[model samples]
Target: MSEDENQISIAKIAKKSTPYSFTVNILAKLHRNSYLTTIHEKKSYVLGVKNIWNDHNGNHATLNIIGKAPLTPFNLDSDIFLASSEQIKNSLGLENNPEKAIHLGKIPNVDIIASPNIENFGRLFITGKSGSGKSYTVGVVIEELMKKQVPIVIIDRHGEYSSLKILEKENIPDNEDFFIKNDTEQKYLGGIIEFGDINMNPGADLGIEYLLAANVEDLIRSGSVIIINLRGLDIPVQENIVMTFCNRLYKASTLREIPPHFLFIDEAHLFAGKKKSDTVEILKLSAQEGRKFGHNLVIITQKPQLLDVIIRAQAGTWIIHKLTDLNDIKITCNSVEGLGYDADEEIQNLLPGEAIISGDLTPNYPLRVKIRKRYTVHGGAGYNVLDYITEGDTLPKSEIVEKLRRSLSHEILESASQEIISNQNLSISDLYHQIDALRQENQELKQEISDLKTNDKDKSLIPEGEMKEKIIDNLAELNSIPLEKINDKMMNLMEERDDAIINLKDFEKERNDAIFQKQSLELEMSGLKVENEGLKDILSKEKKRADDAVALAERAVAKLKKRK
Candidate 1:
């Protein structure tokens, strides 16, 4: 092999480069959608592939600029070699191995680690057709993010992400069984926000506003995850819900009301598609400006073509899976900054669970990664109708009995408590009414007795004197018996009221204790947030010092070479 053989055309170099490697074409590619693969460099020494394209004066080749070794300007016909994998890793800052980098999966010889801190405010967009494992890839990313304790809120359009709370079961539950097969430890403090009566495990059904303002913010601030399940909702209602959430979140972020968090909207096309609506407008705005407020949006959809154009273009990271539609592929290629014709072709042939992660998330070049498996159960798995016909039931009778007993006990206790309170108040009111009626009867009896005595003294009814005395005596005996019975009943009622009052006081004390604990936790979270910000500032300063040192060394080397 002569040295002359190495000097080849730009197209030949791209063709001969290792499979799955990305290249930047310097000459303006005759495509309006050329902005698809642009990557902005953070380091000054790094060759920033500006979206600007030079005129095509026969500079048709692209250079695989991965290594840090600077090269002098060369003509299209000049000999240029591809960088080794090790050099590529070092140039992309992978050699230092930052602790916060998220492991996305692996490429050929290197693991793909994404540093969200290095990206454009953690905004990621994912797209693939159905069954292409886009959702699975999202789950993998979410699992990795969970390890870092990042607050995550997911707009689960199909109620699929609820499984993130539970560990994956060893066996699928029987079709007729309503309970999860295995009772495993919960992965996270996750909750589901729903409008309907259906409630899942590990979470209470919360309304949209209450979840957002009261529970969701608190939960996420405490590093918990929440899913806003919109299953069984009308399209318009779903859109309205998403709109309200996005608008409120953006406003909250702008006002610094909530801490930095990630919002994952699955099936985003339904809300912010090609249609020009409020959802599209707010989503587009959030994608563009939410980064400043630490509001990261991870938009997922099966159809990129249908998603809002502005939102798609604003994504800093893209995890692309197999896309058969030409328009979807075309949109992806155009939105991504550094993708070329070769990468576009690879997108079409990618296998399930395999994705091409490009944009700010990658290390200069696009990486084809085999997404790792989920740590939790995948709720979106396809259901088999035949499973219902099995003879044996997966759920044990004992477990069912225990579950029923617990549920019934809870309902009974709650009902009994309410009933007790109602009875106590009603009994007291009835006693007061009975006492008032008895007092009026006693007064009337006294007046009648006085009148009868007056008539006897006037000699108007001497013959009936004996009959009157008998009537008076009988009336007094009847009143005394009735009064004694009322007093006994009142005493019993007073005992019940005293007992209820004591119970109420105890319940209030418990509630106050819980509130105090909540306040303490919130204060601790605030302290942690302040500490985190301080550390981030220190890291930023250190990074600047390192960059300055590198710049100085490069200049010194250049001067030494000039003297030589």
Candidate 2:
């Protein structure tokens, strides 16, 4: 064959080996909604497809699910799915191809789609690198389940899951279920799991074992969705929570027709060791048993490759979002068989929210899924004081007046300001009232200033905040005097009273330190004096004996002289 003939053959083969997209896209008109498909570098939502066929030679070509720019008043059931690389959160980026996005209308992505017949996928295994939306995805699912009245138990190691329900209280049981751990009534609510609160002897293990058993008793019978969120836990604490929860869940699940709960483990790689830790071993058993007993386990980790081989083997579903690690992708994808994952040499090219979903949810192998927009806030878990709020900057007038009368606002604020106590001395309800008053006062002041700016009101008109301050000072001064007089004696008496108490606590600590030092010095001085007294006694006795001896010698000399 000639060199040119070889080149021609190579070109023919190259032309024939064209790449194809399996993403299902259908262009069908649904109820009167103008629709267009625009696919971009990050995200996609394919709602429905119009056609599925082979272009030629049995090569598959489906309607390429394309994305439309986010439409306002979007149809809840829009036929076309939208995709984009742009993220709802700017801080988070996709591990896969940023050029394409995955947004399937309300379809469960592979991560959450497969579980026993239930409202949710139940237990989940979230795998991703740090800051790769593992916890974020878990929180979003929990938030949804919680809205549906799911009773969630978060074994919070870093306190991330502790605040999951803070913003959703109004939608819950009298706002009681959404309690914060460090909030004023948190101890009373029993969220922290303390020994004394549970009536255990001091320093006992809080009978967590018993709590687990009892909690299972209640949940299994009730057939409620008990989401045990395990996120932000260090490796040790994570293992303990998993160990206890899995043991109890397995026991309860096997014994009852209905399983007590679903278990969600975050950073699953830390505990999913092949060496078989007791915790991991039991968890593996429970994950398998959960399928039969209606209990399910979802392991979440950034390094899915490191998860225990047996447990990963039992996973009936595969939700492959954009994974950056080649080893993780190889381990996770290869670990499971016949799951529709588009594996390639460049695995990192896939984008966020774009996942290859397969397993029980999909009929044939896996399908590419693009997640839809959520109404909940998605800025990943961090403390925002506003998220815990029920009422915005303001409250009712009656509540504010009541707050002032019950605890002196001055005393409460002073206590916090002075650091007299470690906690805010006022009730949360009281603080809310004050917050409302401040908000209302601020609003009124703002409105007044705005009016004054345009109305050219009299200069004599003082702002409400300033007016309130002046009135308070005048009233305080008047209250200090008796009989409407200057009352020098009373003024002097008050001055003495204040001087006597000026930072008594500060002085007390200092005085205590000095007293302790003085006592120690006195002890040392007494010991030294006793030693000196003993030395003096010994010297006095010796001196007495020496004098006697000298007298005796003198006597001998006198006798000799007399004889002479």
Candidate 3:
């Protein structure tokens, strides 16, 4: 090659601008050491790293990593994955008797425990390079739960993880239980309520309330998963519903037996926020006490930074996937260390479906595990639809349409049900097919229509402020009430009505008792008056008798005198 050509080629190669293909097997791995040294903002520290590398001349070049392992650095060499993550801790003289957890591999061919445990109760943390199966990991676990009869409640955003049909490509029983499909072939889990929609407009409130009864029922019953497909929703709404859902379930669970296993929050960072969200209290219940109550939670996310320390700390179990980001690795590992555990050295370099499981969920040792394969029916066989479509020919419309229609119908049903449950007054006017406006002017009055359309342009519109003010004034004048306080007023009115009903019943009972007493008193008074009158009549009669006797005596005396 010419000198100039060689120089240009070398420069391109150095910059990694040249495109080349290789068998790149980027694995997801973890280490408790990867999660090292955390300082509240404004704190800084150095970390030690081994086997750390960067690309140089299209070859792997090692870099100097500042790890808290405090391990002494050896001479610079290409043995990058050799520096133990623990060395840094020792260098810093921060020693603890961290029990040995499971030693995990990058990729496992079987389902094995990362930490030996009665059950994997630890928080499963998902992290990976882009397209490295971060989302796929969640789908895999969910499919497993579906098969095992363990139910889950998911706050799914982005619609990525909820696409169970992709698994059907390999035919693993994706429809044993079904989420209703929409008219557009979008399928959601049947009765698995969704919270918000990102695709629709602002006013289309995703009816979370619609799921209240069924959702609460599901929790009480247990053994059924409530998958909430929260696709196309804004960030704040996602946070609110997730936090709200978990909190509500916990509060309710305290009063009753809740569903087995807690919930899964996919893309958790959105709601985890910069710090712990207002919903942290709810999340804390599931994270800490879920297992004791037969409830468990799984939070899947590629972005670990959004998670607050409480979730990170309480998750007890962490199924950490591959995270190459230095910050992410440090935070995930150090978060574990804070819990008085000292085993972050071995699990961070895992491949797809492999993680260093930690916390109360796993054994003291990290276990290497391969997720079970999903079949088409269990949300499809955990295969990519794009790959299936690309590999095969399309079936006839007859079969295709039926399949698509079935899926879509199910999704629509699920969606509509969710909406209705969420809003008692939601205007579910109709479920008509989406259609374009009709334009049949061929044999009609085209000119008249055109003229009317052109002539009826009204530009004189009132300002929104004026319109709002008028509405407020009119409502106030009519009802002597403000719009803001309507709900409170209505509630008060209902309370008063209830009280009035109780008062009326009591009053009727008291009046009946008083009437009985009055009747008794009248009877007694009448008897007394009658007795007194009878006495007077008897005395008068006696007096008359006495007077008659006196007359008789006088007559007798006169008779005697006559005889003499």
Candidate 4:
């Protein structure tokens, strides 16, 4: 075949021993590209394209090739196989403008590129086991989209996206392609990428109210990325907030003329899992109808089987990394069309950064792809206790303790605040009951004190001798007592009565003060009620004025139309 021709017909293999390794005759100058594959012995072998060599004098050409493994030599036959870059590109249906396409990574050992366009926004599902570089791959995609100025909303369940603020330190010692030059200080390389973090935890600087009050659609339309951090929040609260936000976003997207926006739900299975929740329902609805409104959903989950099957089916693209679960592997195999049995085995053995990409974005087949390195700092790194202890050695013990104390105190205060808010009304009712009981007790004591005082006055009016004689006569009827002993008893009773009177007086004063405070509280409450009523009236008047203004504007527009 001539070099000018777009199509090259190469020699076919006579026999093959294995699936990945096979021999084929070099019939023409066929350069290595990902699309070149040899179907031998009822199995496919990816003919890894290495390089395209042409004669310096334009007299000859050389084709260098590689494969997944070493190949056994086979007889070269007259049978011809056709390979064409134009045919491959046409089949892939890639975008015409490279600038619009986000570069994921290069196709393995091939000149052919794999960049999905922005217009291809739809449900994208990424699944992988933990520590398999799932979040890292996601970071790469997010950075690419950010460079394109596409707005992203991430449901950060673990506070993993906060590190997007720090510049990524690429540590590929020998790979210069991954390194960023010091002179090139860009947003992707550590400069501040503008993002709003809405923390679900009450103690955080930004709370749920901020998220609710902010114009989410406007933020996205203006190309702002928002991260809703659900870390440190109860599962129920997380679910409620996620459901509400998604519902609002869907409604707003439907109402407005806006640019395409992406909603990335990390750990998506929590929201759209086996158990039913409002969040799951909202996600389902969004997955079904969101694409039409330019609202794309990117779901990242480790548990593919646990995810809602309908939502999974809605995905137009899937980036599957290393998964060990048999059920998850089966589900993945079934989801992507044209994934071979051998590919299923390969899924279990895939390296951290290696993945199999399939769906609408691929070339009508599952493609083995090496995920590109991230441009943003990876926030999902695992904790190392020893490393933390060593780092702590640099600081004074007191300072470290103070920092910990502050953190703990803030958390405690947040917990206390939430508890107080939940039970404030109940606490007021309990206080009212306690105060009422005290008032009733005080009234009973006042009556007893008054009776005691009257009795003392009656005793004082009688002659002392006559009172003594009466007490002795009463005591004598029960048991005879000496005159001196009776006198002492009478004296003790008088002293006890006086002490009771004094205590009663103190109780009365306390009761009067309580009554006065109650009266003051009542008056204050009445004034508040009146003020509230007045505010309501003002609000109604303002609403009426707004309606009238709208009516006047409508009338003016109608008159202008009539004149036209």
TM-score of each: 0.52, 0.42, 0.43, 0.54
Which candidate number maximizes TM-score?
4
Clashes of 2: 48
Please list the residue runs of candidate 1 whose C-alpha ends up more than 4 Å from where it truly belongs after superposition: 1-63, 67-69, 73-86, 95-98, 109-121, 169-187, 190-216, 381-564
Ranking under lDDT, best-scoring first?
A: 4, 1, 3, 2
Stretches off by above 4 angstroms in model 2 are 1-123, 147-156, 168-215, 219-238, 257-260, 340-342, 345-347, 373-387, 390-564
Quote model 2's TM-score: 0.42
Question: For residue 488, what is the lDDT in candidate 3?
Answer: 52
lDDT of 3 by residue, 1-564 (tens): 233422221100011211111111112232223321212123333222222233542332212223232222222211122222343333223223223322222224212222232244445556555555566657766655554455567766544543453334443334534322221342323223233332321211233433432345433343344555554333344555566566677766666556556577776665553454466666766777766666566777776765766666666656666777666766776775322222234434565665554455433223335554444333222122234344455211223223333444446657644543342211122112112112434425787877766655431365768868998999879797665487556545754664575497569957976897799889998998898899889888888888889999999999999999
RMSD of each: 25.7, 29.9, 33.0, 30.0
lDDT of 2 by residue, 1-564 (tens): 233322221100111211222332233322211112322234333322223344544322233222233333232222333222122111012123311322222333222221112332544555655644456556655544443333344433332443432333333233333333234442212222211111212212222223333345544432133323322212333455556655766776687744344566654665566655677778788766676776677676667766788788777665566677667887867765443254533236545654555554332334444443332334333233244446544211222223323444444444432331122223365479879999999999999989977656554566779877988999999887766255445435644554454367349957987898899999999988998899899889989989998999999999999999
lDDT by residue (1-564, candidate 1, tens digit) is 223432321222223332122333433222211112112222222222222334554333334444333333222222233333344444555434444566665554333343333333388999998899998888877766666667677888766775665445453334412223444323243322222213222122443333333322444553446667765443445566677767878888898888888999998887777767777888899999998998899999988987888888889889899999787898888888768755667788888988887777764666567776565667662222123324653311212223333444444545533432332212355579879999999999999999978976876555578778988999998877776577557645754664575488569957987898899999999999999999999999999999999999999999999999
Alpha-carbon lDDT of model 4: 0.63
Candidate 3 ranges with C-alpha deviation above 4 Å: 1-118, 165-209, 213-215, 218-220, 337-349, 376-564
Instruction: Indicate the worst ten consecutive residues by lDDT in candidate 3.
Output: 17-26
Highest lDDT, which number? 4
Worst 10 residues of 1 by lDDT: 31-40
